[model samples]
Target: MPFKKYLLTGLMVWLPLAITIWVLLWLVGALDAVFGGLLSVINSVAPVAITVWSEKLRNIPGLGVVLVVSVMLVTGALVSNVAGRWWIRQWDRLFTNIPIVKSIYNSVKKVSDTLFSSNGNAFRTALLVQYPRAGSWTIAFQTGVPGGEVQNHLGADFVSVYVPTTPNPTSGFFLMLPRSDVIELQMSVDEALTYVISMGSVAPSLPAATLQKPKP
Candidate 1:
């Protein structure tokens, strides 16, 4: 019984570490596949000397992550220029003309821009809101105030919140709650997400100032 208990404890300690390493390796492989494609393109059009070097670059471990990051930085710098803006507009126009592709592309592009843009309003804060039934509460992200028809219907007092499911934050419900009813938490979004994903097992600690009693 002691040996069995020790074995179980060891498994518990190593299982999470093993799974994390596997997932990381899988991500690296996927990135390397993309880098491989870029190398193929270079092999076709680049000078023979450069093509030979690029082929060797593929064998370097973890190079894919560096290449991907470099590409993103270069792309960001490029897009900040006037000429790049013109080119991006032309590129967008080309994609926008494709009937079916345009619909999907436009929708995804809008969401990506809203979520990732520095100035975007999405997921601005985390809050506690009553969900499913009254008195029940859940962690939710404040995805800005409602807009368009939803805003018109709900009026200006409501804020749009996304309540992500436990252990999997990707899928969840979107609710527009009245600003008065929503309780704003002092926790950061990452802390709130950890609490949600852990199903309340990993509750965030409130600030000392918040916990302290008011002066009598």
Candidate 2:
């Protein structure tokens, strides 16, 4: 029993590290595949001296990730300019003219903008809400305050909460609960996500003040 316990303990220690390494390797491979094609095209069109160096660069593992990061930085810098904004708008307009591609591109672009923008309001806080039934609570992310038609219909102060499912945080239910019903927590979005993904096995530590009863 002791030996078996020791083996299981060892596995627990190594399994997470192994999976992390595997995921990282797979990501690098995927990036290499995407950038590899562009690199090949560049090499073909480049001068003989540059082409020789590019061919060597192409063989180096993880070079694609570096190039991709550099490209993203340069693209971000360019897009921050007025001329670049005009060019991007024109390019976006071209995509918007396409029927099927327009819908998909616009939806994805909106989501990406909301999630990545520094001023965006999505997932700003964690909350404890009674979901599915009363007296049963779950961890939820505060997406934002309700607005538009939904807000007008509700006619009350309501907060938009996203209750993510166990193991897969991407898919979840969006609920609009009265502000009073939701308990705001000091724990961060990342900490709440870890607690959810671990299915309550991983608990986040709370401050003593949070645990203390409020003054009467």
Candidate 3:
């Protein structure tokens, strides 16, 4: 029993670190493969001297990640200007005009904009709400208020919330519950996610203000 306890404790210490490193290594490998593929395509048509250089570049590990980051920085700088904005608009128009591509592209674009835009409020607030049935509660995130015909039927008092499942937060139920039913929590979105993913094994500390009592 003692040996089993020690082994389990050791595993608990090492498992998270091992998985984190594995994920990083996989990401680096994927980026390197993309860069290598591009180089291969270039080598096919390039002069002998250039092809030799491309092959050498492909052999360097992590260079692909550096190149990708540099490209992102340059692209961000370009897209901040007027000409770049116009070009982006044209690019969006091109994609949005295509038949089948437009549907997929538009759907993804809308979701990305909602999730990542500074003005958007998706997943900003964590809440405790009764779910599945009465007397049962789960952690949920306030995505925003219900919109369109749904809002018309539900009225202004309801809000859209996402209740994520344990261990896998990507898949979840979307619910439009009355605003009065959800209790807002001071814990941050990241903290709430950690709690959900850990299946309630981890809990965020109470805020300092909550911990301190008002002067008597």
| lDDT (0 to 1) per candidate | 0.91, 0.90, 0.96
- With a 3 Å backbone cut-off (N, CA, C), the pairs that clash in candidate 3 are none
Instruction: Kindly list the per-residue Cα lDDT of model 3 for residues 1-216, writing each as its tens digit.
Output: 999999999999999999999999999999999999999999999999999999899989999999999999999899999999999999999999999999999999999999998999999999999998989999999999989999889899999999999899999999999999999999999999999999999999999997896877
In the range 129-186, model 2's lDDT, one tens digit per residue, is: 9988999999998877778899899976899889999999989999999999999989
- Give the top-scoring candidate (TM-score): 3
> Which candidate has the highest lDDT of all?
3
Query: Which is better, 1 or 2, measured by TM-score?
Result: 2
Q: What RMSD value applies to candidate 3?
A: 2.0
The alpha-carbon deviation from the true structure for residue 108 of candidate 3, after best TM-score superposition, in angstroms, is 1.1
Cα lDDT for residue 90, model 1? 95
Q: Give the range where candidate 1 is weakest over 10 consecutive residues by summed lDDT.
A: 207-216
* C-alpha lDDT of candidate 1 relative to the true structure: 0.91
Q: Would you give me the overall lDDT of model 2? A: 0.90
Q: List the residue pairs that clash in candidate 1.
A: none
Error of 3 at 133 (Å): 1.9
What's the C-alpha lDDT at position 195 in model 1? Answer: 96
Candidate 2 C-alpha error for residue 42, in Å: 6.8
